[model samples]
Target: MAAMLFGGLLASNPAEAATAVSSVTVTSVNSGDITASVEGKSELAEFGEAVRDEAPELAARSVSDLAVDYRVLKVDMKQVRAQFAPGVACVDGDGNSRAEDVIVAPRNAENIRYELSGDAQRDPNYDPAKQGNRCDPDLFWDEGASPEVDDDPAASAPVRPYTEKYASACFARKSQWKDIYGIYLEVSYNDSCWSDYVTKYDGNSSWNYYSVKAPSSCHIARGTYLTSCGHGVERNAAKGPVVKWDDWAPAADSNGDCRDKGISVSVGPLSVGGSYTHCEKQNIYKYAEDGKMSSYWKGKVTGTRATQHQVSVRVAQNAGRPRWTHWINSDACVCYK
Candidate 1:
């Protein structure tokens, strides 16, 4: 369930994380997708939650497991010995902190079960087993449970799970206020299929990063990761770094497409301390669905890469609720090819 592609960072509500810049060298042009370290960047900003048994039952597996809205069930791996107890640094961002995870994807991988007649959304009396079923499809992860998913689900068999939609961490701006509530050290990835950790910027704002220095020298050129089509930049969740590129692994592309593909985010004439001479302008982010004000958390989930939750039996299970809700304004950077 892990092809490759990565991300990190979480701050606010006493939240914090991000480490590797000590000499900096997070290289992975395509180590078949990706793999960087610092304990894989704090295991990708680890965070957890799931002990809501008022019917939100979640007991066995290990890392994670829970389901109650695939229209109504399919994630109930009843092992009930004892579970749900992982709240590490919870995706804070203060003053309105945000953190909620429940990536229990396993049976058919996830997002199947639509035929409801109203539009054929699955549920045409969808009976993979019962109504309260999130996944127990009849367990068979490669043998014990982990081939990525599907031992049954009517044997629809097919799961390659991987979701980490945009937000490549490395925000800098918070300058003294006690490091803006300093707590830095989150590098997440508990299988990540349901992620949304925002710290905005923990390095203290006013940045102008530029990387790859020479090898093709970043900016969607050289070997080519993108430099045309929409070009890049659709990240205005709060005015900064939108969908730069993450169709999944080599751009991974498992489906959780960053905003509207054709990603961007290099905007610069950017001068603060001074530098960034010019970077033309790549765009995206003018959203105004106006549903009467919003916090839509930015939208756009293309096709093919957002399917996860197949390695359970707990250890901090978040198999794949791969979410990454971020925000930034001015002075943001991400370039690695």
Candidate 2:
């Protein structure tokens, strides 16, 4: 079993209502594992079912030796105000009081999961036993309680301040395997990344934005070695030029033949590109069977002209029984107006 925590906060205005707050907790369980208590009201219990129906492809991709489950809970507004901003009354722009409700769903879980699994399957070094599960929880708020302003100065203003909300999550499995001169070896691990709700207020109108970014796994196969080469994305930005990446080398023994190790990245409308470094075959006489190597790359998307952009990272491996080279990729997307 594994656990992860994600949180965020938004400032409240004295003249307006405070936004409603919500949270989600994701847990991964193996067959017949001890189940955690499901907290909060069960009114939104159907959320999990909705996810399965709405994102069947994602559900399929998340499958592994273990199954994934999530629970969505409504947050207490009083607690939110006390913790983030005390003494602020909650109200809406229309001068009428408001309350928070779970108004939106998570974004991009299907596309991200599909790409991660599909890309790995397409890799020449892919290993079925190394695959793992992914779990993403979705929670966000739209309207919330606001203080009433009798003589509000902004009431006569042409446009009112409005806030737009967005949230997303993605998880990937990290696996490793080796065949040291006929001695097969294998191991599995899980990794995850997530973004809580992102709120943007521009004195306009409110709308829902669903953008999610997540990491994926990579593998290496060659000579007497066939194992998962870990891959990761350091940042999942909705809009920006800075994103970081990490790619690891395949584990090999003295008799192993590994070469051509590197990482690559691609953004919307851009071709796949990265630094490819050459790794000279280790001296076959070196008896150690636990030697490993690694490589790293940083990627940047220069422009923000596109309304929606997809970011992808690929790690290349040139090792297998027949010495074949292939690339595995992790993909994510962002949408803006």
Candidate 3:
């Protein structure tokens, strides 16, 4: 019975509907016999039968003696885009050539200014002696020029600047439950369908573009069982997105279309046996940007993030016995630039 219930809960088709037992009314017959009037779908009927078979003593208990708990799980996913401008030559107050700022326009329309110039004095990450002339790419139009010309007529020439744009895709899913006399018992499992981020580009230039593929899908499954002590138990499991990046190949891939990363996740089991509640959670954040404007002229960038939470609880029956309940909730998001 437990195996069958687990299989049903973990079914791949999250769209399937399964109703829980809502209420159970007890009545006394003229013969002084107690009868339970159960109200719910097949799942609830099976639950009642399981309880009776495991612990016949519970058959005489009234609705007030049996406690049921309900919890809802929700999942969501979304995508966003970021933009960057072309490189430009810059000079310090002393008239010496310096690394130009890499202007980035995040999704919030706010600009994040930074420099890739391998100058120790400017960026602590760079070693000027080892990484010679790292400022040429940001200071000169022709990246191949040797001797690093400090002043060139073409450096001041008019050039196209990067444009700003936005693109996104979103999806959401929630667990279903049955209401039993104001209490809830989760019965059905649900999951978000596969969603994709359509490619989007700036109208001014095809070189400037943004998008994300291989989006994310969320899953939630739950089942009930009879404990050794003849008590009821509910278990839940769920997973969110884990993004993976492709190998970097500049010449073969230009628009960053090969950048779509895959997704994966691993969730441990959670069990609560008493009146206490327990929860486990995980959060992830990742960001990737073009290394050089010349190679990835599109200035594409991306951010992938996700969060997950699993909760479990055991309700105390009228006789002080424990009845377990558990659920999992998660969400994933991808930001493109």
In the range 242-329, model 1's lDDT, one tens digit per residue, is 2222121111122232332221222122111111111222222222321001011111111111111110010111122121222211
Lowest-sum lDDT 10-residue window in model 3: 75-84
Better of 2 and 3 by lDDT: 2
Candidates ranked by TM-score: 2, 3, 1
Assess the local accuracy of residue 64 in candidate 1 as a C-alpha lDDT between 0 and 100. 22
Residue-level lDDT tens digits of model 3 in 1-337: 1221111122222222122111111112101111122222222233233334223443344443332311111111000000111121112122232211111011121111112222222322233322212222111111111121111113254543331212221122222322333232322211111111211121222121111111222222233211000001111111111222221111121122323322222111211111111112111212132111111011111221221121111211111111111111221112121
Q: Give stretches of model 3 more than 4 Å off.
A: 1-163, 179-183, 186-209, 212-337
The TM-scores, one per candidate, come to 0.15, 0.23, 0.18
lDDT of each: 0.18, 0.23, 0.19
In model 2, the worst 10-residue window by lDDT is 318-327
Evaluated against the true structure, the overall lDDT of model 2 is 0.23
**Could you give candidate 2's per-residue lDDT for residues 248-287 as a string of tens digits?**
2222222222234332322211222222222222111111
Q: How close is candidate 3 to the true structure, as a TM-score?
A: 0.18
- All candidates: CA RMSD in angstroms? 25.6, 25.8, 31.9
